[model samples]
Target chain A: MKKLFKFEFRKLLHSKSFYIIFGLGLLSIILFMILGRVMSDFVGDSSEMYNATATMLVVLPNSGIASLLGTYLVLFACSDFSQHTIKNIYARGYSRTSVYFIKYLLSLAATLTVAIFYVLFGFVFTLVLGGHVASIASYMWANLALQFLVLVGMHGMFFGVAMICNKTGVGIIVNVVGIELIFTLLNFLMQIAKIEFNILDYYLEMILANLMNSQQLTTAALVRAIVMPIVYAVGFVTAGWFVNRRREV
Target chain B: MKVMIENFQTNNVVETENLTKVYGQKTVLDHVNMHVAKGDIYGFIGKNGAGKTTLMKLLLGMAQPTEGQMKLFSNGNLNAERHRVGALIEAPAFYGNCSAVENMKRFAILAGADDNEINDILQFVGLGDVGKKHVSKFSLGMKQRLGIALAMLGKPELLILDEPINGLDPEGIKEIRDLLLRLNREQGVTVLVSSHLLDELAKITTRYGIINQGRLVEEVSATELMQRCQQKLHVITDQPAVAAKVIKKLSPKAVITANENSIDVVGITVDSAKVTKELVKNEVAVQDITFAADNMEDYFIQRMGGKA
Candidate 1:
């Protein structure tokens, strides 16, 4: 199993698309910084620019990390099927369960790596733009934990979808259009409806928002943010493993 | 139970008992009972979509049998013994973006092979100089050789290759054939290769299992196939009965078939001088004489009901 994990990680690191998507995530931060400078100059309000920069860093969990990781996992996971290399793995006596689990862990690790890079870039941009970093630092640890869980949940969902579809184009559509776009839209509707209870708290973006705002870090919120993503991660991976075992490849 | 023990004691590398695979309403492999012996170059012959790949997939445990059992290395535990088998089913599958050596290194790690063995196997398959060229840039024949190289890793006891020469030129086909033959001869590796090119397969295989429409029509040794496809002396005469009687008198055990206008002497080395002299002496005039030798293609066509 260690051998399989190492081999899969090597393949992921060697993939051109993985680096391309990761570069895109970093590029988005630089682009956001540039856009803030131009907007501040035009509006003659430096405070607006600082607020936008802080918002970008705050929402990096959902917009930058989750979306980019979702796209990357879709492309990376489906390559095994599209390229037919899954046969080589199975032919070597590795079970489908081990393959799926290793892939899941790899996706999580890759997402965490990219997310860290995004945070580093965000910090540098804040310093370069002359904005105080103290506001972002207070919630940084909490938000980082929340982002990690969100990524775990997101990776699990995308991994399951890609494994089930086993086609690159279909995987991309389901992850980007089906899961991300549709779930975000549903969460927006819940906000508009002004529901008393936060039923959509389990949704990835909602979890990110609540974790970013909660100052006390209560037990119930911790369960919702931490334990729920773990449940999503475990549930989706188990289902994907089951489906993958029976697939003909 | 007795039959199981008997098969286990023998040198069979692969044995399937009434194995069947069904996809939806169609049956891909129907009750396929096949045996590949140790150190035998077993050629699995079939046409396209004839369940050749399906059987290989089943033996590799890539797919489960719908109705029966498969034993590899005489063991019923497929998972434990599968590491001793290496297979390339349908096409050569590899990480296209990775270099040939990189792809091989990954497989070596999975197969528990030492990293040093990678270069040796690559050179063995004629891909030594591929260097850092990714597999996506490789030609079809080059990719096929890499696939063979991957399968040859870990020095597996059995190698199952399906249509390894599908898109290769004549030279490429000959190279693969020679490699397989050398592996079987020098390393004593049991090989089960499937191909539609009967003539190419005939040159290297020691035993053959001919499949038609998901059924194993026949399984015979190369020597037996040669005997079955032996040349016959066809004598065309106006009076075949007289020709048969005259030829029968000389060689009493000769297999003479008297047709409408010709007599076929099966499995007999007819000395033209002696047979002609005997026919002239018997007042029989031979209008035409020809040797009809059946090649592998002709035999395959005949076995498959002329479908080939």
Candidate 2:
């Protein structure tokens, strides 16, 4: 077991894709920070509110939060199959279960790292520009962490899709198509079902809106968000491993 | 000179009992019963689509046999043997971004390699110097070498390689050949190498199994195969009628297959020079003369009802 874990981690660390993804995380974090600082309005007493709004808008729309997060996480998860390196991973004698789990953990770690980095830089930028550091810092941290959970969950959903469509090209196409078509389709369905949850538009849109609003997360809401992603991750991972083990390579 | 079956030890490292693999209506492997000795270098030789890879996969537990049983033995317990087997089937693919050393490190860990054994095996396959260099830049031969290095990491008693030298150059092939030999001879590793290169297989293999279409036609020792190929010499002469008369009178057991002017004669013991001299003395024209025992390739062709 120890040997297999070391092997998994070693492969993950040595992969060029891993480095590329990590670098992309860092670059995007910096890009978000710069955007936050430039667009921030520091006028009179309302300067803190303006800075907070600017940071929320920049992070949520472009970097720290929603649509961008989903894309990055999905891309990172699918890159393994895209490059056709899954065979290499399994041929090393590690079980399919272990491979998928390790990849899940690695992607989680990377996403969290990016989330934390973006929040840290956002703090430094806000302070230098004469914004309310204490009032907004906590919100920023909480929002960033919540956003991280959502990103993790979104990754799980994407991972399931990846397994369902094993080919990288198909996975990408499905995700892009899902993003473009699902929102409207879900909205229409929600009206027909008379459901108030508004899940269709809430997937990426709600996450984006919350980032900009600095809305406090209720315990139930937080649990629902966290648990929903876990369900997707576990379900997809099981199916993926099952399909992988049974299919002839 | 066949492999003596009764005298062979019963402690088999790998045994397949009536293994069958079918793809829909077309059977790829039909009831293959293979028993690889604990310390034998079993060479699996066959033409394309001979189910060599399928057999290897079944043995490795990568693919389940459609209908059969495969058992591994270790210390008289089958379960213990599962952890001891190591294999590399098809091409060895690695994460292109990682270095060779890193790839080995990963495989060594998963293969249950000890701390020192990891680096030792890397050096064994000549990938130690490729320390930080990513695997993407490594050539095909290098990847194969690394693959072997990974397979050898745990020092498995059973090593299975399928078409291992597919893309290697002459020097690379020679290097791998020597490495395999040393591993088997010095380390007591039982190897199962499947290849189409008969000459190369004939060099280091201790045992041979010939498969055709989906059935294993023959399984014999290397010594027995070499001996069987030495059955008789073939002679080609310019004058058919005269050469036939001379060969029949000299060696009654000899058979002749003649064309318009060229003739093929088998079963004569005389040297080529002596036979040529005798044919000329008898007024038979000798256009070109060549005599040698049939090789494994020839024997395979003959067994498959094809002239070689």
| Per-model B-chain TM-score | 0.84, 0.77
Best model number under DockQ: 1
Give the top-scoring candidate (TM-score): 1
Clashing pairs in 2: A3-B109
Clashing pairs in 1: none
In candidate 2, what are the lDDT values of residues A94-186, reduced to their tens digit?
Answer: 555666677667666766665666655555555565665344456556666666666666666666666667675677666656654777787
Candidate 2 — what's its lDDT?
0.67
- lDDT leader: 1
Please provide, for model 1 over B1-308, each residue's C-alpha lDDT reduced to its tens digit, 9 standing for 90 to 100: 99977865478899998999999998989999999999999999877778999999888767878999988888898877878988898889998888998899888888888877898898888999988997999998999999999898889999999999988999999998999988899999999998888889889999999888888899999998887678778898999999999878787877888999999887675576788899998989899887778777878876765653
Model-by-model DockQ, in order: 0.55, 0.20
lDDT digits (tens) for residues B12-45 of candidate 2:
7777778899988988898887778878899988
TM-score of each: 0.82, 0.74
